[model samples]
Target chain A: AQRVTQPEKLLSVFKGAPVELKCNYSYSGSPELFWYVQYSRQRLQLLLRHISRESIKGFTADLNKGETSFHLKKPFAQEEDSAMYYCAPPDSWGKLQFGAGTQVVVTP
Target chain B: EAGVTQSPTHLIKTRGQQATLRCSPISGHTSVYWYQQALGLGLQFLLWYDEGEERNRGNFPPRFSGRQFPNYSSELNVNALELEDSTLYLCASSLGVGSNQPQHFGDGTRLSIL
Candidate 1:
């Protein structure tokens, strides 16, 4: 079975500190990974995808095929970056399997 | 252009009653997906519809069924609803059935089953 795992339910970091939200997946095919974010009082939106190799809102994720991981990382966390992040793996048919999501809180 | 839209932002119903949720995909999107997001649980795929056909479905009971209309609008029907069915139902739309396009979501409908 294909599954995406987000280990942390909630992660807290001080402003200007580094932040890393872990994500791992189990799949047999050439997996396509994505990161989706939902800010408070806002709808869920796409953040970035591994295939595009692009970073959005100062956050970037690299697909580690050997480790089967696509962890989201940021060098300097900002207060505005606090939000719920979800790691998703879209199947060949475009059905997205999402992780439980990790809530990040950046303290000032 | 407007993004994906879902009707009935919030609903309250008793157990055993039926509930219907509607979704309207983006103007040109041919694929619509339904998901259930229970509190503290990840989003679970419910159904996938494309071009007025049921393309795929998740591990759900027969009572959880839905259909797509000719215009690509979709409806999810849950019969004999259970307390566990209370969840935030989300609808998403994509250009087609592939990874080339990202799925855009609408503000979900929060269903409360008593």
Candidate 2:
């Protein structure tokens, strides 16, 4: 069985501090993971994908195959970064298996 | 291009009533995905459609059904709605299965079951 777990339900951080959201998955094959963000009253949007290995909005996530984790990280948390983040891993048919999601709060 | 779009921003229904949600994928996208986002429970995959065919379905009851049109648009139908069915229904589109493209989402439809 495949499952995604996000250990933290809520994370509060001060502006300019670093923020990290942990995501661990259990899958049989090579996994393709993604980070999606949903802002207040806004639609969910793709933040970054492990395949791309790129950063978006000062956020980046690296897929660690050995540890089976894809942790999203940001050097400096901004007020705008406060939102709900979901880690998604796709099944064979391309259906996304989303984590429980982590709510990040960056206070100024 | 316009992003994936879903209709009926808000819908209210009584128990046992059926609800149908619509979605129009972005142009050139041939895959559509449906998800349910309930309070506390993050996004849950409901269905996946590609090229007007049902590719896969999530761990949902048969009462939760949907179909995709030739134009790549899709509709999700939930029968015998219950209070637990009150949630945000999200629609997303992608280039196609195995394309490794990021799915684009739309402003979800809020469904309230009383």
Candidate 3:
């Protein structure tokens, strides 16, 4: 079965420190992955997608098919970056298979 | 434009009772998806509807049922709710089937079953 795994449940970091949240998936097709974030008291929103290869809010994720991973990275964490991040890969029918989100806490 | 919207921010019910949650998709969106956000289960896809038809569903019991209307608004009815059913039910919307559009989520309805 196709599945997305976010190994970290919580990541603690100080302001200006680099942060990386790991995600691995098991799927059989040309994978298209996306990252979604939910900040405190806010609705969930799309952060970035692998296909676009674009950075948003200083975060970028690269799809490594060989490793079956699409890890989110931020060179310098910010206080506003503290939020819940989920790595999702759409299923064959386009339903997002979300991982067990990782909560990132960037303190000042 | 307004994003996806869900009704009744919070609901409290007892076991064996039924709970009905509503979701209104974004204007022009034709697909609505329901997910269960529990404490540890992350987000489990519950159902997907498009054009007033049930397109897909997750590994949930029959008690977890829902439908979509012509306007693309959706209703999720949880019958015979259990204690474990306490969760944040989230509703999301996207473009029609086959359209590669990201889903927009609502604030979610927090269902608490005693």
Candidate 4:
């Protein structure tokens, strides 16, 4: 079975500081990973996907096959970046197996 | 184009009653997925539908069932609802059934069972 693990349930950081949300997965095959974000009172939305290799809102995640990790990172965190971040792996039918999520609190 | 849309932004039900949730996929999207986001439980995959057929299901019981329509819309039905069933039901859409594309989610219907 494919499983995703997000070690942190909550992460607090000061504005302008670097942020990294750890995520690890167990999958036998080459897995596609994604970082999804949910702002207060907003729907869950895609932040970035490993396949796309693109950064959004200063956030980027590298798929490290050796570590089986796809940790989300930002050079400098912003106050508005506070939100719930979920790490998910897609199944064969596109169903997502999501982690418990990390609540990022960026303090100004 | 409009993103995925789910009806009944909020729903209230009683124990032993049935609850039905609806979803309309984005334009040109043929695949729909359902997920349950309960308080403190995070997100749990419920079902996956593609081309008007049930492609996959989670470990949930048979009471948790759903179907995809020809137009690519879908409905999730939960029979004999329990208090534990109260949670946010989210519907997502994608281009097809695979890991290649990321699914887009709706705001979700918040269901509260009393």
Q: List the candidate numbers ranked by TM-score, top first.
A: 4, 2, 3, 1
A62-84: candidate 2 lDDT, tens digit per residue: 77888888899999999999999
Q: Candidate 1 versus the native: TM-score?
A: 0.95
Give the range where candidate 2 chain B is weakest over 10 consecutive residues by summed lDDT: B94-103
Model 1 ranges with Cα > 4 A deviation: none
- Candidate 1: residue B89 lDDT (0-100): 96
lDDT tens per residue, model 3, A1-108: 788999999999999999999999887364567899999889889998777665579898878888889899999999999999999887777777799999999999
- Give the TM-score comparing model 3 with the true structure, all chains together: 0.95
Better of 1 and 4 by TM-score: 4
lDDT values, one for every candidate = 0.89, 0.90, 0.90, 0.89
Docking class of 1: medium
Model 3 residue B80 lDDT?
99
Model 2 has an lDDT value of 0.90
Off by over 4 Å in 3: A28-31
Interface RMSD of each: 1.5, 1.7, 1.8, 1.6
Cα RMSDs, all models: 1.4, 1.3, 1.4, 1.3
- What TM-scores do the predictions have? 0.95, 0.95, 0.95, 0.96
